[model samples]
Target: MEDHQLSKSLQSIGKSCFVKNFELFSDAAISDLDAMQFLMDDQGYEQTGARTRVREGRRIIESGRAKDALKIIADARLEDSTLADKAYRLSL
Candidate 1:
């Protein structure tokens, strides 16, 4: 698949996985840097945006800014209801 197609497909898969298994995947965590590297290598997906968000959210969680991550995910949910539902459910 073309890069655009791959990007879209990966995004879709990410969204779906989040919706379906976010509870298991949540905890406001960022996967290891090696995991991010693997994603970039295997999928050619850029991790800067998503990884940065996850890292920042993780920091907030660590710093007792738990609500910050909630707000960010809530805003994301508003932009994408499916993703929002997944995120909200994961948050619980």
Candidate 2:
């Protein structure tokens, strides 16, 4: 699905379902910044959603999901040039 359409569809169904479906359908991962945007903007999670993504991102990395975790960080930088430093720090 396209970004806007995905956002709209996520807004309609809610976060839990989105997360579940995301895990099931794709190996592609979500960046922390994108996660914040996805949760706060698309899922209506606000600031708490950003926090949730940070925690979840940390957990994913700590749990040895390194490949996926790195992809999350890399994606944020690759998708947005302005986020390079933040994404680098996030990966470290």
Candidate 3:
């Protein structure tokens, strides 16, 4: 991902935008999904899956971890055009 593009994307995700339309970076979401699945299948709490994921997402954004998450995604996507597409879709 180009630095300019990544910077623009991160700048766009302000507090109000993040709080109102909560979601995660694609990679973080996938990791959360894996943990959630484990909780539901092994720990016997189906409801914990969604609740835990949502709570975690909130914490990440509210605590400024979202910035870190987005940076990581951008770094991983660095030579891949899909970075722009992902940033656009996430409204980052």
Better of 1 and 2 by lDDT: 1
- List model 2 lDDT by residue over 5-92, tens digit each: 4344334433333233233223336655665666577556667655554455344434455343333444542444544444444446
Per-residue accuracy of model 1 over 1-92 as CA lDDT, tens digit each: 34354334335445433343333224534354754464466556578844643343333345543433444454553556776765565456
TM-score of each: 0.41, 0.33, 0.37
Report how far off residue 82 is in candidate 1 (Å): 1.3
Residue 9, candidate 1: alpha-carbon lDDT: 36
Residue 33 error for model 2, in Å? Answer: 1.0
Candidate 1 local lDDT, residue 40: 60
Candidate 1 regions exceeding 4 Å error are 1-31, 41-43, 47-54, 75-77
Off by over 4 Å in 2: 1-18, 21-29, 61-92
Candidate 2 has an lDDT of 0.44
RMSD of 2: 11.8
Best by lDDT: 3
The TM-score measured for candidate 2 stands at 0.33
- Models sorted by lDDT, best on top: 3, 1, 2
Give the range where candidate 3 is weakest over 10 consecutive residues by summed lDDT: 12-21
lDDT of 3 by residue, 1-92 (tens): 34454344444443232332344323454565664565466546466544454445555555555665454554444445565345445545
